[model samples]
Target: MKINFSSKTKILLYFSVALILGFSIINTVSFFYIKSYIDKNLSKDVEIFKRIYMYEDQSKLIPYLKIVDSNQNINQNDIVGKVDGKYIVVDKGKVYTELIHFIISISLWEIFILFIILIIANHLVQITIDKEKELKGILEVFILALTHKIKNFLGIQRVNIEILKINFNEKALMRLEKAYMLMEKDFEILIQALKSLREFRDKREEIDLKTVLEEIIKELESIYPEKSIFIKLSSFKVKADRTDVKNIFFVILENAFKYSEKRIFITDSMEKNIYTIKVLNDISFQEKGSGVGLEIAKFLANKYNWEIFNQSSDDEYIVYIKIPKK
Candidate 1:
């Protein structure tokens, strides 16, 4: 069987491995430094004591001398003064063991503290990276679905237009014109969909939400000459990147056009530091297709962490979006 990991899982795994490896390397290096420092200092102490006893005053050597007897036992606090040139060398293990234990314990704790700090930093970076990857994945999928739906709808329009072209009588010509108009309207909707998809897929900067909606409304007027689109704006903004927001608006407007039998009512609200845009139209349940529009809108909404609510009654269809103000 084949296994696939989500981007978040991959990031966590990579972070864990890096965190562990980094701490391990640091601990190893710290141990090595301690070992070298201990070895060098021990040798230096032995050399200094040897020189003092052999050439300097042995009477003063008592204070600096830590003697080890032949049984390999050392007395760290013992005072043994010698005359002019005597040596203080014993072979004992007890004093040496105690000194080694003290140094190792202190060095081990230092290494532990450093490793802990590095691990914490790694975890924080991992969390940020995982969040970004998760958002990227969702956006990619949503855009892909949008593209698929646009193409499918466009293809249907093309077939309908071609059928209309083959009929050329006076009465047929009138019906052909209506079919051509529908095909043209579908193309306009595709353009709106593409506009939204491009913004997200290309990672555009922040856009004026009001301006984008106005543009969508302007285009809708031309597309549906038989239907009216009304807008009521109240100074609200979406805390979404430009491209994502454009796609979101495009999807909403497209739904309005698809469902509205006569008129579409659109309005915005900004209250309690939150922005809400509502688009309402009348629709028939029989008008539902493969549900591509709703699906694409939902997919992209999740990508941006936006809340989407849909409500429909026998006489009306409504879409409400709540956008947080950053």
Candidate 2:
């Protein structure tokens, strides 16, 4: 049996490998660079010290002292702390341990800071690449669907135009007009989708959840004036792309408003790090009609790593959206 891994699983595997390789390369580079740096500039007086003073390069100590031999190839201006570490330098036939100590103090700190920065940069770059890949997937699916829709509409429009031109009857004209209206509606939907995508680009900020919901509710109320709606939402601050969050809740709330028989009730609560929203409404139809709006909401939720699902019974429909309080 062939096991088809999910996109998310594949992304995770790639991300893990990238992180491991990135850290391993950084570590290997740091080790070699530090070793080479010490060899060229810091590890020059170890043999001299061991040969002259019988002081082990890895086990020796001193204060602010300087020792000069008659045939000295090492010079010590000043030594701070312990001198047991294998840090030695030879310059102009002068053994300099103090300079080696200072070099270690400075170089190690610099390397550590650079290492941390690289790790952070690597993680951020990986996250950005992964998100872009996901977006590309969404765009590909959308374009394919859009192309199919355009072909279908164009085929129907062409046939209808030919019929009207040949027959010139009331029925043919009505059919052609209906096709035009449907095409216009599709264009409107396309425009809205494009607008949403444009608005959602790189716009991350703190959003007042209740405030945004109220705005969506106002807009939806204008569309469904006859529908009685009630809301009891928490004033939680959520950090996300504001337009994305708006689109998610807008679709769910609008879906509720569009299908309700009499009244719609919306409420929110927070548990742990998850904010849960519930939209309940009396169903006017048993079938719940087409679920395009809910499907869109679910897609947006899944894209952002949130949770959204629905439940329906004989009398009512309920949509639940779980968002993280980040």
Q: Where does candidate 2 stray beyond 4 Å?
A: 1-129, 140-201, 286-289
Q: Judged by TM-score, which candidate is best?
A: 1
Candidates' TM-scores? 0.65, 0.48
List, residue by residue over 1-326, the lDDT tens digit for candidate 1.
99998765675577667756776676677667766775575556566666565454543543334434434553543423323344354332433564567656866775686567557755776777866675676566556665665666566556656766785456445444554564465456456555655554545466667888998778666656777778887655445556556667777887787667888998888778678889999774544545556666676677667788889788898999887787
- Per-residue lDDT of 1-326 in model 2, one digit per residue for the tens? 99997655566667666756765676567666765665564333444444444543323442212344334444353231123443233342233354446556756775686567666766777787777776675566456546755776687678878887787778667656655654564455556666766564656688898998999888767656788988898788867777667767876786687679879999988899898989999988633545555665666677667899888898888888888876
For model 1, state the Cα shift of residue 242 in Å: 1.9
Position 157, candidate 1: lDDT: 59
The lDDT of model 1 is 0.64
Q: Ten consecutive residues with minimal summed lDDT in candidate 2?
A: 78-87
lDDT of 2 at 14: 73
